[model samples]
Structure formats: C-alpha cells, structure tokens
Target: MTGCKVVAIGGSAGSIPVVAELLQALPANFQFTVIIILHRLKNVSSSMDTILAGKRSGIMIAEPDDKEVIEGNRVYLAPQNYHLLIEADKTISLDYSEPVHYSRPSIDVTFESVAQAYADKAVAVLLSGANPDGADGLLAIVSQGGMAIVQDPATAEYPAMPQAAIDRNRDVVILTPETIASFLHTLND
Candidate 1:
C-alpha cells in the first residue's frame, strides 16, 4: 500500500501467449493493480477475466467499474465499449466516449490517466498491438516522469505499436515481455 500505484499493460492478437509467459515469469507476490488494455468490439461482450483467470492466482481479476478503487493485488481489465481512465484519487472511471485511434477502450487514455496520477511511480507498458494507438500515451507516461516500457519489436508478434512508440519517443524502454515482467518484480523491492 505504500509503493507504486499501478501497472498499465496494453496488448492484442498474439498477446495472449506473451502475457501468459510474462505472468508465469513473474513471482506470486508481484504487486500493483495490473490493468490490461485490449482491442475489444464495442457490441460484443468479452470475458477476458474468465479467460485469464485460468492461468494464475494470488491476484483477483475483473472488469473495472466506473469510480472503482484500484486495489493492489488485482487485475482490472478494460470493459468493452468503454475508455478506462484512472482518476486522480486512484479510482477508475469508465467513459462511453468516442474512440481514439479507433479503439473504444483506448490504451492511450489509460496511460495518460496513469501518467497524470502516479507519474514516476506508474509503469505504462505496451505489448503486441497492430496499430499506433498506444504510441502517444507511452510518450505521455515518460513526459510525466512515469516508467515507459514496450515489448521489443522483434519479439512482439505485432510490432507496429512498439515501433511507433519507439519512433515517437527515443527514451522509452523497448524490451522483451520477459524482461519487462522481470523489471516489474524488482520495482520497489
């Protein structure tokens, strides 16, 4: 309760396997509320929680509700048709607003929210994604003094998102999924 506030992760398509490997690489007590931003259809309901819950334990996982407190030791997933924003008070706010970069639950929005809230204590991560959606947001995290990490383009199944972030911001940490997950384990320890 007295450390970094959040870990915001973005991914899509081939990200499932990568995320699984990252989760497996991490130790059980890896703290912070892990927020996952995925490309989801607005009209279709998704059970990402149920899908990922099959993998591991020691952390609760669910779709985030508007104004819900982001607790440590939980995974808050962005629901379909909503942009998940982290408020200044460390709670989540769901907005059914228009899409940014054609994404309903934009990764950019989530990263910006975390950047504004926790700054240097926040960690914004970009994984395998097709478009350039998370590029600006990753830059925002660095601008706000938060840690910015992206999956290595060579390792990422879809490299555009990570490549875009790197092209936009040179200082970002572009690493493999395993390395990023390991880095999280060392934070605040």
Candidate 2:
C-alpha cells in the first residue's frame, strides 16, 4: 500500500485499553488522520478524551465539533449521544438521530461514512466489543477497496465484534493489538 488518508477505528466493550495501547505505539508525528468511534452511554457524561490525552502519547485527542476539518496527527473521538459522520469535504458532522444497535455513537454509521468519504484511501479497524455493530461497517470499508483489519478474536476481551467482522469478510486482515500498531506504522508517510 502507498499511503492512507484516514484510519477509522471502532470498538465497544473491553476496547479502551486496547485503543490506548494502539495510540501509544504511534509516534508523535504519525501522519494519518485517525477517527475513533467507541460505544458510549447516551445518558452519562464521559471524560474519555481527557483521560486519553492524559497519557501524553503526543497525539492530540479530541471530540470533534460539528463541521470541524479533519487533520492528520490527531485522534478524533465521536462525542457522546451523536453519530459521527465523515463528510465528503473532510469535515466532521454530528448527527443526533436514533441510535443504531442501541448505541448513539454507532460504529457502523461512522465506518460507512468513512468508506464513502475516503474510499480506497481509508482504513477501518474493528476491535473488541460485545455486539455485532461493526461487522457491516467493516464490510463497507472492504467493498470500497479500503483495508479492513479486525482484532484477533482470540486476543480480544470480548470477541463478538471482531468475530462478527471476520464472519462478514473472511479475507479481512486479522492482527493482535501490538501487530495492529505495527501495521499502521507502515502506512505512516
């Protein structure tokens, strides 16, 4: 692969630690714009962005505001109670529509949008989760000729999400948390 423009990661149960590990491995100057969609409770407040930022991984972690431009070297998280959509113009759009799979920040919604916005230049990673939300979205990425990586189910704390993706696309790349980071490094320009 030459270089990808964006890397969209989705996860739910038992994912925060894995996500932090992946982010920690990326160098401070990593060049791909990273969008992360994690299942969050609609009625509760979260300081996840702040918690991740406290890790001092050298990457800017934020919950993107509506219409914010997507930029490389930053990790954007979908805010609570909104479906994060990637616009064709490379801007973020938040939708307060009905939840998908009972989750507000639906991984499927973001992943599909990313597939449309970045097409072949996109990379989608489905991580540990208890539900099947990300499976279809991972397929969408693959359909667009983008790379789809699923966390090795054996290593995932909750295997349903990754396994669902694997079932949807047998050829999707499967990697452990450490290897996922290594593979992503190869895509950095």
Candidate 3:
C-alpha cells in the first residue's frame, strides 16, 4: 500500500470501459490517489466524473478544484477545458493553458506534471486513445523513475495512444484490460 503513492491514468477514444473495469477491480482500501486525464471537447460540459463515480466502485470520483489536496483512495478527473497539474505540494491545480496535442486535459501535460511532483512514487498508465498525446509523458514518467504501463495496442479500440507510449518507452508494461486490472491489484502488495 505504500510503494506507489499516486497513480496517473490517461486515455482517449476507447478508454472508458477499461477505466471502468480497472476502477471496479480496485478494492475499497486501495492505497493510492488516482488522477485521470482524458481528452474531451473544449466547449462541452463533461459528465465523466459523474458517470465514473456512479459505478459504485467504492472510490470517490470527481473533478478537483484548482488547489484541492490530493488524497488516497479517490479518483480525480480533469475538468473540460482545463489541464490538470500536480503542484509541488502534492495538491492539484487546473490550468487553462492552450491545448496540447490539440486537446484540453492532455495526458502528456498531466503525466509530466506528476512525474515531477511524485517522482518515483508515481505510476502512470496510458490506455486506449486515438492520438499520440501520452507517449512523451509516459516517457517522462519513466525517466523520473516512475512506473509506466500501456494497454496492448492490439487490444485497444484505438491503438495510437498506447502504441505511441510503447514506441517511446519500451520498458512500459503492456497488458489487456483484465490483466491490467489484476496488475493494479498487486500495487498495494
């Protein structure tokens, strides 16, 4: 429960089911805080937090305020039109920086920030997505001595995001959704 203090997960086009499954598989006492960034429309209001929270996974899921404290056993989603950042104090901050990779709440931005904030205590996962947004960030996480995981491209609805991360960071652990869930289950051990 103490090895990894934070988990950052990002995805796009085809990640919802995987995310749901992963969350469902986690126990109520799961040890780390989770931060998620999924590419979304700049103008639309996102119901992602509500939708995910309703899953009854025993984890609280919500969009965080600009300077909210990061807590364990909860999931925080990046708000639409804002990029979520991990402050040095281990709190969250939302930024309106111009979209990276043509998407707000870019995986790259969140991953990079957490890589620096939590360093080796961080774990990053790049799931199914249509673009290459998370590859560089995953690499950054690894460069900072954090763990990186990617969905196997063959199992992804959109292979680009996972594949990009694989291409950039060869050391990434790649697995199917079910297997990924099982792997995450071991994090606290």
Q: For residues 96-145, could you state the per-residue lDDT of candidate 2 as single tens digits?
A: 99999888899999999999999999999999999999888888899998
Stretch of 10 with least lDDT, candidate 1:
18-27
Report the C-alpha lDDT of model 3 over 69-155, residue by residue, as the tens digit: 998888898898899999999888899989898988889999999999988999998999988999999998999999999999999
Candidate 1 residue-wise lDDT, 1-189, digit = tens: 136668888886568777766555554776677888888777776787777776766557799778898888788889988899988998899998899989988999989988998888788888888899888998889998888888999998889888889999987888988788788777547
Per-residue error for 16 in candidate 1, Å, reads 1.9
Worst 10 residues of 3 by lDDT: 52-61
lDDT of 1: 0.82
**What ordering of candidates by lDDT runs from best to worst?**
2, 3, 1
Model 3: residues with Cα > 4 Å off, grouped in runs: none
Each prediction's RMSD to truth? 1.9, 1.1, 1.3
TM-score quality measure for candidate 1: 0.93
Question: Candidate 1 or 3, higher TM-score?
Answer: 3
Query: How close to the true structure is residue 91 of candidate 1, measured as C-alpha lDDT?
Result: 87
lDDT of 2: 0.90
Q: Estimate each model's TM-score.
A: 0.93, 0.96, 0.96
Assess each prediction's global lDDT (C-alpha) against the native: 0.82, 0.90, 0.88
